[model samples]
Target: MARITAGVGSSHVPLLGVAADTGKDADSYFGPIFEGYEWTRAWEREEKPDVVILVYNDHASAFDMKIIPTFAIGCGERYMPADEGWGPRAVPPVLGHPDLAWHIAQSLILDEFDMTIINEMEVDHGLTVPLTMMFGKPEAWPAKVIPLAVNVVTYPPPSGNRCWALGEAIARAVASFPEDLNVQIWGTGGMSHQLQSPRAGLINREWDNRFIDSLIGEGQEARQISHIEYLRETGTEGIEMVMWLVMRGALGARTRALHRHYHVPCSNTAIGHLVLLPDNGEQPGTDDDRALATT
Candidate 1:
């Protein structure tokens, strides 16, 4: 039984990475935006959890736009970082907790949750950007990460409600595991800024705030929202918020948000950062291991 310490989520905009590394977005672009991640360095040093369950949507990478699952989990020992033009950022590959990952996979299937399990997959900025931002770009990553990828690209994506349900199922799966460990679940991407089409660079702060409010406040209902409504109202790209519901559902119903930051104008994306610490209701797990993986 791993105690979930924190939940992290951020947008995977390639432009931000390029700017951060090239030293181009010092003031306007990267500076203010990355402030949300500064807390990550502190969390790693202070609240270092045993494992992190990352929820991000892959964009045309690994699975491609061909056949995508509503939710996919990586059970491999390591995951490769996708090359996003500027080349891989020289970080340790993410490690996966196969035992827990497999357990969730089995439980989800039995509970009627459709998901994909990947032995090998390359993660793009969708998972890496926010990661490096929060944890800082060292030669390698410090902890193990389990990727629970969701599909927000092609049509027929899962609804927000479905994503939240998946989160609840995952929590149950983890709780049932015989082992004890401290885990963190993260959901990344989106805050209402479309990145494609002629109307690119659109920003809807109002909608973004509302989504955040509903996500942290509403439980099952927030997760159960329809995908059609998300796409129609929030724009196609905005549908990514469904992933957040997964993280919200996994955490305690009455979590205290430690920090929150939102910014737009990074290559047509609204970057949202949130850190939720689960309350003292849950008991601590008795486990003894740190996780790290390279894929």
Candidate 2:
């Protein structure tokens, strides 16, 4: 039986790269608060997952406000990096496992979970920043990634509960794969900080703490929290916390959190990291996890 061996979460703050490239110990800004990534690094090495289903919010990168899909699956062969204010980073284009992606899509649709199927797309900083932090470079991703893009920029986006349901759908999709593969699903972004509107730079430690705790403790139950409550209490952009639930939902009811970190003011963002290991005792990831589409 296929099982999730590891899971990771992180904030995809663009400012981190801006700071790093400018030659600053970027960690100093968030050092006091973000204690999650350091632990996640160790967990990544220990688990060594092969494929990671990365769940992240697109910041008007691939999908615009015009047409947004609550859940978008990448079924493309390659994804171009987006052009931020600066020119697009000259990193490797993201390659996809189209066959597995189609399998996941077909299974979810059959399960009554509809999703936007994307065959050609370009991922923005929201996806790459976290990858750079986790894999050390855009060209050297430790594992093949299945991009699960969520729309967080639009008003009245998918509810937190809806994101959780997507996670459950993803789990069923992966579990039903006929081929044998060990996979790790990653949920990136969020930990109580706002990046848009006048409330930008807002960091709510109280809310961040509550969210991280519930993610580890309550699991899917955390989805019960309403988006209105999150926006009112944690700030609108902080709604990205809903994306984190996707990771927790993929995890077993009980998991061993290997490490965690959090930091604030990481270049106009809150930086956070989390790592989880499935308690069932399996190797982190297998070759099948990285298999590309077999035509």
Candidate 3:
């Protein structure tokens, strides 16, 4: 049966995608930010999973105020990069795992979670940026991706608890798959940083680190964090951090933190990344395991 071997959480700042696409990632300002993912790139090369369930928000590219689905799963065959105003980034189109995606959608619906099934939709930076962070500028993404777009852009987004429960349901769905495939669930967006007025350009390093610590440890604290707390402490957009809990919950009750990286002021956002392996009694590697494991 298909199984989730690892979980990854990352912040999908749009500027990061521009920097990479324009070859500015090697420049001084963005170089350090891109460097943080070097370890992850190498690690992923060795632990290549066949399928990745990417959780991200649409950023008004695919969905807007007209129609917004709180939870949508893509069961399409391919997804082109969306043109967010300027133009679509020069990136490879995303190939979807329709079989797995449809299966997951069915399982979640049967499990009492209402999910919108999308047959075709253009993907924005919210989905592509994390792929760039992990796989770099490849002609084609190494893994087949299943886009799971969550509605965190609009008001009254799903609660952290709700997202966490969705993750558990996803794990159950993946386990029931008959295919013997390696699967990875990824949650993207936010550490903290708001774009709106009054408290715009906010980056709470203290709270961000504390949240990362909670996730790396028992994860109970992160799981219990409320929506109001995120807005009050981390900024309005900081609510995006709740998505990370989905990745954490899918890793089961316990997980071994393989690697973690956190950086601040990246395009006015706190860029955070984590690589976690399910705790099944085996020890993790020591060499380069904590290379970029800064909090």
Candidate 4:
């Protein structure tokens, strides 16, 4: 049966994509940001999964004010990069795993998640930036991607607890699949950032680090964080962190933090990345340890 081998949490800052595409990632300013992912890039090459369920929020790319689904799953064969005002980034289209995606959509719907099933959608930076951060400038992404978009941009988005429950359902769904495939769940966006005025450029490093600690430690503390707390402490856009709970929930009861990188002021957003493997009594001297030693 197909099983989730790992979970990844990351911040999807659009400027990171720009820096990578324009060859500015190696420069002094952006180099550090890109450098943080070097370990992840190397670790991924060694432990690449067959499919990745990428959880991200659509930034008015596929859906507008007219329609918003609390949760949407892309079941299409391929997703083209969205042209967000400036033309689309020079990246290959994200190929989708229709069989697995459809199965997941069906399982979630049956599990009473009320997921919006989308056959076509243009993926924006929210979805693609994480891909670039992890996969680098590949001619084609190494693994098939299934876009799971959540509505974090609009008001009354799903609660952190609800997202966590959804992740559990996803795990159940994946475990039921008979295919012998390795799957990874990725939750993208947020380490506390606000894009609007009044409190624009808001970033709470202490809160972000604490949240990351809680997420990597017991996880229950992170899952119980309230929406108001995210707004008041982390800022409006910081609520995106709730999506990380979804990734955490899918990893089951215990997990080992393989690789974690945190950086501040990435285009006024805190860039956070974590690679977690389900703890099955495995030792810590994995590839992550080797990567960290060299870096």
Runs in model 2 lying further than 4 Å from the true structure: 21-27, 30-36, 196-198, 280-295
> How would you order the candidates by lDDT, starting with the best?
4, 3, 1, 2
Per-candidate clashes, comma-separated:
16, 8, 0, 0
lDDT of 4 at 105: 94
lDDT of 1 by residue, 1-295 (tens): 6566667666777777676667665576577776656766676667766778889888777886577777898888888888766677565677777887888789888999877888888988788877777777676676778898998888777877788778778888878877778888888878676667866777787777767666553344666567666665667788888888788878756555666777766667677777775555543356412221111
**Candidate 1 or 2, higher TM-score?**
1
Q: For model 2, which pairs clash?
A: 33-262, 34-262, 34-263, 35-260, 35-261, 35-262, 36-260, 36-261
Model 3, runs deviating above 4 Å: 282-292
Q: Model 1 off-target regions past 4 Å? A: 24-26, 218-221, 280-295
Clash-forming residue pairs, model 3: none
Residues 51-100, model 3: lDDT tens digits: 99999999998898999999999999999999999899999999999999
As a whole number from 0 to 100, the lDDT of residue 181 in candidate 1 is 81
Better of 2 and 3 by lDDT: 3
